[model samples]
Target: MDEINSVKIEFLSRSRNESFARTAVACFAAQLDPTLDELGDIKTAVSEAVTNCIVHAYPDSLGRISVKARLFGDSSLEIAVRDWGRGIEDIGAARAPMFTTGGDERSGMGFSIMESFMDKLRVRSKPGRGTTVTMTRRIASRADAR
Candidate 1:
């Protein structure tokens, strides 16, 4: 896996950008020859991360969201989604299952879903700066693992 083959995308922190993020991840994962299930998981996890940024990161402020995907040369991929908005005050509680800041409608399962679907998950945030979510997953390819 060469550096030139990596994929990256950037979009506004809006609900509409969710589709763009999903497609970008799916297309990149396809090039890596990930299994169908792996692709779906990536798309779902990406969607959750992007959605969280749009819904929580910036309430009324419009900002840009950036996504970068790189093949780890181990039949796995790493994705990072970043936003410049109000960051999570408590990452520990925010990541807890069923813990949402949204009053009633939000399930707060975004991080949980991402953690379950991806092999690894990391989150960094500052109170007033922003949040970045990093996720990685194995491609489920026997040949590529070598």
Candidate 2:
């Protein structure tokens, strides 16, 4: 495998940026020869993460979100979504399936969906600072592997 290639993009915390985030990851993963399933999984995970940032991150103030994608030598892709808003107080509870904060129409499944679709998921948050979610997925090489 070759060295990991990466792409980074930053955007405002707006609903319109969700499509941009998904497309960015899809375009980058295409270079790695990811399968259709792999691409779909990446797109879903990216959408969930980006949506969470737009909805939860900065309820009162405006901020920016950053997304980074890195294609590993093993054909696995790692994506990191970050936001500088009110950080998560309890990552453990937030990660629990169907656990969401008050208000909003969210199903509280963003983190869960990300974890289920990706090979690995990591969350880092600091109250009053920000939160960062990192997700990784391995691309299948052959039809039998699918």
Model 1's alpha-carbon lDDT is: 0.87
TM-score of each: 0.92, 0.92
Q: How many steric clashes between backbone atoms does each model show?
A: 0, 0
- List the global CA lDDT of all models: 0.87, 0.89
For model 1, how does the per-residue alpha-carbon lDDT over 73-93 read when each residue is reduced to its tens digit? Answer: 666788999998899999999
Q: Candidate 1, after superposition: displacement of residue 74 in Å?
A: 0.9
Candidate 2 local lDDT, 1-146, one digit each (tens): 56579889999988888998998889999987777888888999999998888888887666899999988788888899999999999999999988998465889888889999998999999998999999988887676466
In model 2, where do residues sit more than 4 Å from their true spots?
A: 102-104, 143-146
Q: What's the CA error at residue 85 for candidate 1, in Å?
A: 0.5
Clashing residue pairs in candidate 1 are none
Assess candidate 2 and give its TM-score to the true structure: 0.92
